[model samples]
Target: MRELRIRAGYETLGELHRASGVTVATLSRIESGVQIPSPKTLNRLAPFLKVSVEDLLAAAGYLPEKEEDPNEAAARTIEAAISDDPELLEFWQELVKRDDLQLLFKQVKPLTPKSIKKIIKVIKAIEDAEATED
Candidate 1:
């Protein structure tokens, strides 16, 4: 929510009211997620919040981004940034998508082709012996 407030240049409820002409109670309720504004209210609030009206759906988890939270908030910031970045598109194309099994692969680069051949040979020997005896 800090991000929204910062973008709107509103540090206080009074600032929100002054900038957008919304009543303090209404703005407070909206910010606190106690009330979901109607479309017209949202349209007025969006410019005041410096966010899109669609971003006001807090009941549906349309959270105003708070950059102070290190984990979830930071993750959302990165996602929003990546979706907007052009250079990141090239980098993403070169890299595989991050997923559960492959997450460690991103931190650890793979071995050379020669080292892979040696590893594959050990696997083949193990398989061949298993097939012959078992």
Candidate 2:
């Protein structure tokens, strides 16, 4: 927390107190490891330090460290692609809600715009085939 405070340019507890409204004494205690910051305290400090409360909690040993899941990371990439094209957003939003298509979406994270359109067509064709089979 102290490193975060310093990295954010808060040189002293007084500076942090002025910006975060947390008392200097409490900030000092937290930084010196004399006290574990409560969730409320972490919430107050996180914004001033430009970090999430979860990060502060993890640093303070309150929460387990987070690891990014590959599928979720891939989904974020796909979502970024969808957001960049308004035309894609509507269709992509619906497609992304399908659990069966999740692995396909992950595999296509690096697709070009043309490739995305091709994939969309293939997906539509598959859906049509499945409907006829039903």
Best by lDDT: 2
Q: What is the Å distance of residue 8 in model 1 from its true position? A: 2.1
**lDDT tens digits by residue: candidate 1, 77-114:** 33344554455434433333446524433343445545
Q: Which stretches of candidate 2 lie over 4 Å from their true place?
A: 68-134
Q: TM-score per candidate, in order?
A: 0.41, 0.50
Clashing pairs in 1: none
Scanning candidate 1 in windows of ten residues, the lowest lDDT window is 69-78
- Candidate 1 regions exceeding 4 Å error are 1-3, 57-134
| lDDT for each candidate structure | 0.59, 0.79
Give per-residue CA lDDT, model 2, range 1-134, as digits (tens): 77899999999999999999999999889888899989999998889899999888998889998988877776665566556666566666677789897677556547775565666656767876998999
